[model samples]
Target: MSHGVKKRKLDKNAQESLYFDSYSDVTIHEEMIADRVRTSTYRAAILRNAEAIRGRVVLDVGAGTGVLSVFCAQAGAGRVYAVEACSIAEQAVKIVKQNQMEDRIEVIRGTVETIDLPESVDVIVSEWMGYALLHESMLGSVLFARDKWLKPGGLILPCRAELYVAPVSDPVVEERLNFWCTVRDQYGVDMSCMSDFAKRCILSGDIAVTPVTVEDVLSHPARIAELDLRSVTAEQLRSVRGEFACECFGSSAVNALCVWFTVTFPCEDNKTLVLSTSPFKPETHWKQAVLYLDEPTDVMQDTKVAGEIHMYPSEDSARHICIHVDYTIGEHKKHSKTFSIPDGYSEAQQ
Candidate 1:
């Protein structure tokens, strides 16, 4: 139930540098590589599509540690251009050599948009998904590589993606909101007055990234947006807007909207491989994005919450994501709110 707010806006260059610098830390990469659901799904997708990769030149965009590039090489890719803009590329260079894949892999330490390859690639692979599918804005780089280097009819490792949303009853929010009352009883200090201030601080800005369980969900999930990586354009990604209407399973108070995503890989024999970050499925590094409501709304069985959700890059930092939600619960008046996914940079001085 913790939240963060950006105290000051950063210039584009500073923001870009901060984003890459964070990736240089080994901890972040360790989390990603250790996410079994995330790593194994990608491995299955690459191996399942081995025929498409064999004898083909491939490009791995934002290739942190070059794991995916190695997978492609093992799948018999003729050559792999592993493009990484962060210092992690140095580790990727060592990893490729240690795997005895130096001949098939070329680690390029530059942004995909600025890097030049000797020839077009028959396949483009990348694990560019961020929280809730678009938070980090890495899809833009993948699209750039796709347009600049992918051969005609070339395949995207995860060819399609979908974002989903549903109303949820989060007991943790209520517990946090009520903690101030406990302080008064414990220490004879009337800190209960801070409840309003605490709520204000939480709902003020920044979306919470937490693990949501199926029991917490109050309604069936609805698909809000689907992106076909092969054809979706950068302009289209600038703002992804979709409308959703979900019915509550029973009586409960809705505290927030739970969001997650899934990506698919098209394989041979008409089979499709899916990697989901849904709470109903095994958890991944991307647990879920929860947008807390200013006030909880109680609903009865079959109550409907209808709304439109809009996701876009923050104007201050293109790498950050902003979400706008306009929704009406049952027959109540419409409620509108916007939340931002924090850039995770250092807090600005007060």
Candidate 2:
């Protein structure tokens, strides 16, 4: 490729990295129903514990495919506010009627952040777990709605949540570092060799450095960020920064970071409902994204290094949840992000 073409590709990868960095891989749309949504472990947790919804005013946030909302109605909610964005909101509307819940379930076709509600709810029912349970970052929207319309004592599904991190076995890291070293060498011979190095840097990694879900990082995860659903907010979620002092496993280059968290809500009978581990679950078609590190670092196990990560929500749309993560490992760094809708758009454009 020509010099300019390669530059464009590198820049494009960076942009995509940011756009998809925080998106989940589950799909709860019509196409994702039986195969993806209904059988999810997260959803299973909710149905297993249903006593919380009996005769309650429940608000279902991100009511995609209307699965969770319909379930809330079936659980005997006094009234179900099925709020959703995207065309799937129409599907949710149809599902409410198909389930003969048109009288009890109201479908609001807008983001949870700005939708209007007729009354305060007794409970908030939503499946907002993205890949790693926060990619779509829909929890912020849920929290916003709760603060605005949910009764003080109302229930929120996925009441408690936690993010875990661990060291894992990955060979991709070594390959990436070696490639970067090669590129640095070639640069001495030819300044034009820069483009090849950039592309190779994107591809090579013996250890893994992408922003993978924390679940994939270790067999058993260590809780990095534990959060409560009722009180967490978008502003508080702006940055996920932490310091890690551990070995890189030498073979592991620590190309990217993987982060995953879980949400737990209390259902009836003191049983807990969960999203990340339920037979019935919401769907996100996007796979857990891997945020490529801007740079890679190498070390061995028990190596002491500090790092910080961030997921920024775009202040742009009613439901815009974007992410930006920067990990400073040792002296090297890498970052990835998924843009919330862009911020600062004019009223007419918004």
Model 1 off-target regions past 4 Å?
Answer: 1-8, 343-350
TM-score of each: 0.95, 0.66
| Residue-by-residue lDDT tens digits, candidate 2, 1-350 | 24465222235345334333322223424334654532364466556556667778888887776777777776678788888766666766777788898998888877776677878988887766654455435777778888899898778776887764444434454454355456547776534445567655453321121334332342333355767777777677665444443444444455444444556667566656544432122333422334444444565554444444444433432233444443445455444333222222211111
Q: Global lDDT for candidate 2?
A: 0.56
Q: In angstroms, how far off is 98's CA in candidate 2?
A: 2.2
Alpha-carbon local distance difference test for all models: 0.90, 0.56
Clashes of each: 0, 64
**C-alpha lDDT (0 to 100) for residue 249 of candidate 1:** 97
How well does model 1 score by local distance difference test?
0.90
Give the true-structure RMSD of model 2: 8.3
Best by lDDT: 1
Candidate 1 per-residue lDDT over residues 1-350, each given as its tens digit: 44385467888889888888878888888888999999999998998889999999999999999999999999999999999999999999999999999999999999987878999999999999988788875899999999999989998989999999999999988998999989978999999899999899776657888899999998889999999999999999999999999999999999899989999999986989999999999989889999998889999999999899999988888878899999999999999999987545222200
Name the runs in model 2 displaced over 4 angstroms. Answer: 1-39, 131-136, 167-195, 198-220, 244-252, 269-273, 277-289, 294-298, 314-350
